[model samples]
Target chain A: MKHFSLRKLFLGCGALALFILAWKLVTDAKLVSPIFFPGPERTYAALVKGLSGGAMLSQTLETVQRMLLGWLLASFVGVFLGVLIGVSRRARAFIAPTLELLRPLPASAMIPIAIAFLGFSDNMVLVVIAFGALWPMLLATIHGFAAMEPRLYEVSALLGLSRAQVIWKLALPSAMPMILASLRLGLTISLILAVVGEMLASRQGLGQSILAASRSFRSPDLFAGIVILGAIGLVGSRLLSFAERRLLRWQAVSR
Target chain B: MVVTQLSTRPRHGEGNSTPASGEARIRIFDVTLSYGSLQIIGGISLDIAPGETICVIGPSGCGKTTLLRMLAGLARPTSGSVELDGSVLGGPNRSVAIVFQDYGKALLPWRTAAGNVSLALEARGCPGAERLAITREMLEKIGLGRHADKYPAEMSGGMQQRLQIARCLAQEPKVLLMDEPFGALDAMTRQALQDEVLGLVATTGATMVFVTHDLEEAIYLGDRIICLQPNPGRVGRIVDVRLARPRNQLLTRENPEFLRLRRELYDLIKDDHQ
Candidate 1:
């Protein structure tokens, strides 16, 4: 099994190397115009320069800041609403339909309306990211609270736990795994929406950098921007999973 | 080995400093529980004395669990009252705790053994500084002190059940109600836990209502056994277990009176099934 993982990693790296070689071969053969598809060497140089000693570093930071702020806002609102809907059947019945109606509408599609309301601003980008990221956490929390074992409630009553005690001690802990899972999903959505908002709203992030470079026919700069975005996503997701593993370590104990 | 453990455990005067506070007399009067038009516990009544162990035995669909739930104040009787020490039971009384059948579901899977036990103390508003000592003390009492840091999923079935019982005991409850708590365990673990429960009851002198399907278990553990008939359950017969105190599992099983009582209970239960 250990060798299998090593072999898997080896295979993954091999595939990436193969793809890069193929792209270089296509450029060498003049299969596409250099103006359209930049050579791998030029793309790599652009990536190194932008990250090490250029404006791309600041662009990456701006994107990350917006994403994190939006995710934090989404998390607070999602958990508050989720707990409210989870603990009360009346609140769920009253609020669930509207949420369901709004849930299916794509966040990207709302960019026009968002721009109309709060045009070309950082708040607009943050709001778009927050709105896009809230659903997963909200829905996950409600499901988590609903799916709790019935017997635990009986134990709670037998212990004479008050309403507040039940919520703080039982409800929150039981719902934590799902909440964390949804929060991870929310973080990913926050990143995606942040980039989209930056591109559409003409803000100073990786998304705007890529779009402007593409329009100006700077293909190397465009590819560099995309690579940085991928690296950011990889790092963000790994961090969230690390926290998830720590929080839910017990679930893995006997199983 | 379990029998020796049972016989050698702490006696009433050994562990408890205040015996009277941990004992409660349960008065049940014509309590009938219904779900819409369906009756469950059909007008049953009984009196359980302090420190006396009463085992309830009945066939499936006999409202055995419902009766236990009503006593624990987890369910309300549709038309009657259950009282503890002459006070009418309203909601869950702070002085009562229930040990449920499915230990896995009853426990908080995330909390460690000590944390689960501490849940009861926390519910009762036990001071933060005092919780650690009481949690450790309760776990040691239930023979789970070594596994204090282990989660419920990490423990065996018997250990999980013991943890559940420990959690209940941490409440310092006056009346202990168990609803087939050992039904999921192997016979050996069941016997060991039964003896453990017997020892705790002896030490605290708490009134106990143990619900089980096993006749020998009822005879071994109870001062009296209430056998209920099926289809809207009510008492069929109440048999007195005149066995001596600190009863040996092996010796008590061999006793002619035990055999005779077991025979009588078998016949009574068989009649109800018919």
Candidate 2:
């Protein structure tokens, strides 16, 4: 397993190296000007400078704060409501169509409405992130709860579990792996909405900084901001996957 | 096969009799169980004497398991009522423990062998110290002390079944209900566990209601074998094995009476639609 993982790591590094090589070639060939796509060294220097004495750190922190709050809110509400809807057939029938109508409206589309309603506050950004993140988490939760094996339910019944105990102990734990999967997916959505909300509805955050830098033709600064967002996203996803691994260790032991 | 009126006959009117000491543990009176439009077991009744080991055997879907579930209070009778002690059973009775067919699923995967056994005691409000003590004792009795810390998934099929049995016995119920507990194991494991089960029953002296599909097993373990036929299942015959106590597999299989009972049971259930 260590050998396999090392080989995979090397392969991923090689792929990144190849992409960078291509990017360098395009710049060297003047296929696009430095103004449009800055070189890696220039972007790195700008990232360092921004971190040292600029607003980049605060912007990144702001983005992270908004993202965390939105994602956490979405996850809690999504799971609670999803379990409720999933367990009761009548509630599912009544609520499903309304949720369906709301889900497909893009997170980006919500920006205009958020701006109209909240006028460029952090509230607008939060609304965008939460609305966008909730759908995947909710869907995953519903699927997880719905897919519980019937035998487990029978065991719960035979053991004389109350409805609440059944949900808390059996249903929740059994649905955990799937729920974690959705949370990871939802986190990515939160990142996208976080940036978009900042870009369209708010005047501060990584997204706003990137937009501001681009307008002033500070290509390296814009790239640095984008890189920070990418790093946050990559780290967030890894964290969730790590959590999934720990929580579902029963599966590992079985294997 | 639906012996409606036959089961209604009052065999023992003492309500509760141990029959051994002339006391009663449980009495079933004209109990009929149904689901939706289907009547599964109609007007069926039996008395489980204290410390008796009774096995129910029939073809598939003969409601053998349903009867066991009804006794366990996992299922309610549609018409007549089942009684435990002298009182009518409504829901799960306090003094009954059930071991199901699927040991893999029956034992909670999250809990270790000892933890699973401890649940029964925990439900009965046993203190933590007593629970731990009883769990260790029961696991040792089932030859599973070494695997007490292991989760159900870590054990083999036979070991898991034993763990479930230990769990049921840990509850120390007066009446024990087992629903084909070894049905899913390999033949060798099944036979071995059968011996172990008989040994446990002999030691504990709890009234046991075991459900099985195999006739030889029924004869090997049961003091009385109740046979049922399908369609809407009901008791076809109640053959008293009358085998001597302290039954061992070799001795029981070697007996002519056991062989005859197996043959008779096979012949009776041959046409069952299940």
Candidate 3:
């Protein structure tokens, strides 16, 4: 146990150390010019400048606000639709062909269509993220429910459980692990869509900041913005994983 | 210790103490089950009194488990009907419970031992206090009070099976149908659980219809043993175990009559596979 814990600690430290080393190397080597791959110091300078100026801070706030809205909306809708499709064979049969057809099309691919129909609005971005992430969540629900033992169903029936009670008590709890896995995948996809949606068709948020910097050839700011994006993605995924652990502690203890 | 002659009289308890309108505790009338055109068990008729322990022993694919399932309301016979105290058995009746052989798949991994038992009660609409009380009582009965907080994966195979039993018993059902509940356990654990089950059954006064392939297990625990032959399963013979109440597994296995009866059952059904 001691060795295992130590190894985990070492790996975590190793990752952070690697990130600092890579940043130092690029700055020291003058790799790809400071204009393109700015040093960590220059990136920090840009972050300070962006924060001091309320304009950039508001954009940052707007970006996070939009991400939260889109993420929450997509998660709720995806899980609802997923449970519906998973439980009902008729729904599955009806939607299977259509889902197969639409699932492969990239969320980014629909940006132009979204813009055309709903015009560069928050609603359009939300729709794209929901559409993209729904597949994984839906597939997880179907698989998790299908994998449940018939014996559990028999037990439920023998107890005279109502259909709703059966679904909430037995079906949902059993499918939780897979559902959480799907949520993780959905979260990742949502982040990608948020950035892509803002980049393609938006007047606010981090994506626009990157685009503005790129257009002006202010490479330091662009690199700094990209760094922040990566940070958000990393931290967001970690938060999700932490929540999953808390929710599935029973499952972990069993193992 | 032969208590009484094997009653060859057809199971007719119409005028018994149980109210005339009330159904037989377990009534299987000419139960013939099949999968498509191939019938598995034909014309199976048996009536189990309340709290009686009946062990069905037969060769593989002799529809012993099928009969148990029929009693548990998991399956319907192709030709005849199964009734629990007069009500028709369709789907799962609230009063009947089953403990399966594959405890691995039977218990949900996400639930704790108490949670697993409590789930059945919850589904049965038992109030929170009542559910908790019954869950606690049953877990204590099975000697799993300490492990109530543990999940199935943390428990040993025997513990898991005991949890299954506790879960079934918590419902306080009138009839308990078990299909090879201990068939998967090691010999030592199986024997221990056999005694545990005998004690539990006597205390609960729940009619038990257990299916097993082991002749010794059947002869040891069963008040009456029904040996079945395969290839369109049918009841081959019935052995009345005259052993006294609260059977001792080790002592009973050593009994001359027990050995003879066990051998007789095996000999009768030995040709089933061929």
The candidate that achieves the highest TM-score relative to the unseen native structure: 1
What is each predicted model's overall lDDT from 0 to 1?
0.87, 0.81, 0.80
For model 2, residues B46-109, the per-residue Cα lDDT tens digits are 7778888888888776788888888988788877778888888887765788888888777767
Instruction: Put down candidate 3 lDDT per residue, A38-134, tens digits, no spaces.
Output: 7778777888888797456777777777676777777787677777877777888898898889889988888888889999788898888777877
**Residue-wise C-alpha lDDT for candidate 1, range A121-215, written one tens digit per residue:** 99999999989999998898788778888888888888888888887789888999999988889988999999999998999999999999999
Lowest lDDT block of 10, candidate 1 chain B:
B1-10
* Cand. 3 TM to true fold: 0.91
Off by over 4 Å in 3: A1-6, A19-31, A52-56, B1-23
Please give, for residues B75-172, the per-residue lDDT of candidate 3 as tens digits. 88887788777777887876888898999788878888999999888876789998888898889999999998898989989999999999888878
- Of the pair 2 and 3, which is ahead by DockQ? 3
Model 2 C-alpha lDDT per residue in residues A1-255, reported as the tens digit of each score: 999989999999999999878877887787888888898778889999999999999999999998999999899988998999888778788988999899888888878887899888988888878888999879877877788777667656555557886787677877888888999999999988888888887558899999999999999999999889989999999898899888876666762
Query: In model 3, what lDDT does residue A152 have?
Result: 80
Q: Which candidate's DockQ is highest?
A: 1
Pairs with steric clashes in candidate 1: none
Native interface contacts kept by each candidate, as a fraction:
0.79, 0.15, 0.77
Candidate 3 residue-wise lDDT at B259? 80
- Greater TM-score among 1 and 2 belongs to 1
Regions of model 1 farther than 4 Å from truth = A1-8, B1-24
